[model samples]
Target: MTGGIQAQIERVRAELTSRPEGLQRHVGRVLTEALDLARAWDVDPDRVELATWGHDLFRAASPAELVTMARAAGVAVEAPDLAEPVLLHGPVAAAVLEARFAVSDDEVLAAVRDHTLGLSEMPMLAKVILLADKVEARKRQRAPVMKQIRRLARRDLDLALLCWADWKWVEERTHGWQSHAQHWHARAEWVRQHHGEVALPPRVPETADN
Candidate 1:
């Protein structure tokens, strides 16, 4: 490689390393695979890995904190709705990446933006980012308590989202905290409709299911 390309690569790596959000160890590893997939599939490898890392920038921040930050940054999200928390990092993260790191890759930022929603006909990079977030360390403990999640994750993603729906239901009910339970329920239903074969949660009550 030429010195100019090597210099550019080092600059990008430095940006990745200096990120204060502190990427999880396995997230870093999965990005290696994400980059490999991006290469195999003819996508830009750097942008793919960058998008994967950029997806979780503000995850450690509370929803209120994100709303406050958003307000400060002029995004104008009102009252901290379920959508706000679900997409806390997405828009702002992309904007930050663009401003600070000059990440102009359309597809990379696109994947980062839609990482939470699992939008229609997800491409490989988007799926990779979502799965990376799913199997991440913060979610590891939530796994065993969720038998249906285990089954669904292993069997079918549509059902997996259903299990995730019920899991969030029980979790929110127990903790009595605000969650994106409704939005996730809707997303699960959407996936089930188009993707097919996902059953409603076995033990989830109808009230929570909705």
Candidate 2:
């Protein structure tokens, strides 16, 4: 597994000087980091690629269709559990791995399923995927998200998830955001499921004198 990963890295690096060089490198780094996280968490090394491979699939997705597309893939998605971190690709990948590749490897599915928000009962690989997405350099907007990721890296998953919920709130409030609040509502459900608070952080103060 390690050898295969190393080979993949080499291939990615070799293409770093090609078209969209920066993007290629960024993808390479994210892939490497995700694999590293998986290994550190004692995930099956062979299954680490699932996280590294598709961590950024949604990068180009229309934010509005992100969860919809994931849900459209066909799996028994629970109402609240159907949101967040699961929409993060944990279940989609799990289903893909099961139905397509017939891998039936628990660790791989676990890594994919929990890559986004987080699971209440996080498996090793799941945590790795979460951290990998949160810390990847391509996600370099150091405002709210970076702040929370750095703070939550060494802390509790539930706490980190709360911070992410705050980040989601900010996005919803951002100008020209074309997405809906389904994920927010969905996240609220997850927060309730996990016994956490469901409130978004206080809105960025509007100019009082405006």
Candidate 3:
């Protein structure tokens, strides 16, 4: 952890102070999980801390607020993003972190950007933050299966991500909710890679925000 990164972490953490209490607590738990995973993965804890603090900067915003923020941050608002503005929170936060907060680390910004709906290929830091967010203490309590995912993450982050995506797929199907195209594409790639497939079957075009 360089002095600059530690400074960035504090700045991001300070920004998180004004968010809702529940969100702050959630971020706290995520920090705990992320730092542990960072150590296990031999990643820098300062970078993990910065991303964890910044990931949910806009989580508690209303849909209209999210959309407004997204536009202000220059985040593209796709159909899914307009329909579910919460999806833009990650991108919005990432943009703000760079433009406003001077967080210049590409991997750190990528971790914050992709934490909500993971990308097909992520830096190790992104993987740690994404898995940590999903398997935080409250989330594990809400979904018992998160315990298994959390355990798996310690050994295999990619496998844990695939399992979490599978669970998310089932969840959306059960609830009659639409799967975001970006995540669906990412999940498809993970499935293909996991099975060592060279090509994927034809599917709906990825045309929405994650």
lDDT of the structure predicted as candidate 2: 0.55
Task: Report the backbone clash tally of model 3.
Answer: 0
Q: Residue-wise lDDT of candidate 1 within 1-210, one digit each (tens)?
A: 234433434555565565554565545755755565455556667556677777766656678777776666555464544355546666666666656556666666666766665554555566556544565544556575444443344444445554555566677679986545435556656556744534544545569547
Q: In candidate 1, how many Å is residue 58 off?
A: 3.3
Each prediction's Cα lDDT score? 0.58, 0.55, 0.93
Clashes of each: 0, 3, 0
- lDDT per residue as tens, model 2, 1-210: 233544543443343345354555665666666666554445565556645554443444343454665567775555444443335345554555455445455665666665655554656666666666666765756554665564565555555555666675677678644332444554676578556343655457689774
List the candidate numbers ranked by TM-score, top first. 3, 1, 2
Model 3 regions lying over 4 Å from their true place? 1-3, 197-210
Where is model 2 more than 4 Å wrong at Cα? Answer: 1-26, 35-45, 56-94, 113-124, 141-148, 176-186, 189-210
Name the candidate, 2 or 3, with the larger TM-score value: 3
Instruction: Please name the candidate that would achieve the greatest lDDT relative to the true structure.
Output: 3
Model 1 local distance difference test score: 0.58
Clash pairs, model 3 backbone: none
Q: Residue 46 in candidate 3 has what lDDT?
A: 85
